[model samples]
Target: MLSDIRPAIVSTILFTVLLGLVYPLAITGVAKLAFPYQAEGSLVRDSAGHVVGSALLAQPFAKDEYLHPRPSAAGNGYDPTSSGGSNYGPLSADLAKRIKGDAAALRQSTGHVQIPDDAITTSASGLDPDISPQYALLQVDRIAKARGAAADEVRALIQRNIQSPLFGFIGQPRVNVLMTNRALDLALPKGQPKRA
Candidate 1:
């Protein structure tokens, strides 16, 4: 009995240290060294060297000039740390109400009555970094108008910035909201411009 208890205790202690502390530290160290940018949270910076946000998570943009990410059920929209979907089932009345409210608000904000499902629905993780291409395009008119840029020019920029699905078929096509907004800032005419 004594021998059995002693070996069990020793093995448990050894495995805990090896798996819990040592293994995690080793992997983290290797990842930091090999993939510094990603290991550091894949943060994006502006030309002025200001930290904007991480490429991994989406941020909320209420202004019509910026493309908005999917509606987040987290704290305020797009709260990364509080990542989670609303978890409302299809027949849930709360889901219906939220979608209706979102669609109405989007129409009012952009003055574009056509709302995509992506615009009205939240992603499962609540940290989706991309919006459907259609949703991104919906904002082009509003943003172009706000910036006094031609719709065609904004459309071109959106096209240029669009990223295809991983492996060309894994997930749906999406446009990164942060990248699109940053490009908009840079793509608008430098001097006086004509509005469409």
Candidate 2:
């Protein structure tokens, strides 16, 4: 009995140290060394050198002069602490109602252009920073009009910021809303109010 209990206790302690502590630390170290920018949360900064937001997480942009990210369901929308989908089923009435409302509003704003699904749907994490290139293009006219810039210039900006798929294959092309908004600010200098 003593032998069995002693070995079991020893194994628990050894495994705890190895798996719980050493493994995590080792992986973190390797990640930090190998992918320093990503390991540090991919934070974006402003012109004044202050941290603005992360390149990886979505933040809301309601004003007309900037591109909006996908609708967030995270606590009050885009709250990192509450990142998650609404979990509405495909047949759910509530989901359909919301999508209909969003689509209607988007059509009214963007002159009835083809609506991309990403423009109306919340991402699984509810905090995806990237929107489809099509969705970003949809907002170009609105943003350009608001900023009092030419549509072609704004379209060019969006085109320049379109990120390619990871390793050119793993994911779809996306436009990071925060990065592009920052670029919009830099390129147009609209003096728009800052958002989180």
lDDT to native, each model: 0.83, 0.91
Model 1 lDDT vs. the true structure?
0.83
lDDT, model 2, position 144: 91
- Model 1 scores a TM of 0.88
Residues 88-127, model 1: lDDT tens digits: 9989999989888888888987778778888889998888
Candidate 2: which stretches are off by over 4 Å? 29-35, 191-196
Looking at model 2, which ten-residue stretch has the lowest summed lDDT?
Answer: 187-196
- What is the per-residue lDDT of model 2 for residues 1-196, given as tens digits with 9 covering 90 to 100? 7779989999999999999999999999999999988988998876677887899999988989999999999988999999999899999999999999999999999995689989999999989999999999999889998999999999999999998988999989999999899889888866556542
User: Which clashing pairs does model 1 show?
Assistant: none
User: Model 1: how far is 40 from its true place, Å?
Assistant: 0.8
Give per-residue lDDT, candidate 1, residue 94.
93
RMSD of 2: 2.3
- Specify the highest-lDDT model's number: 2
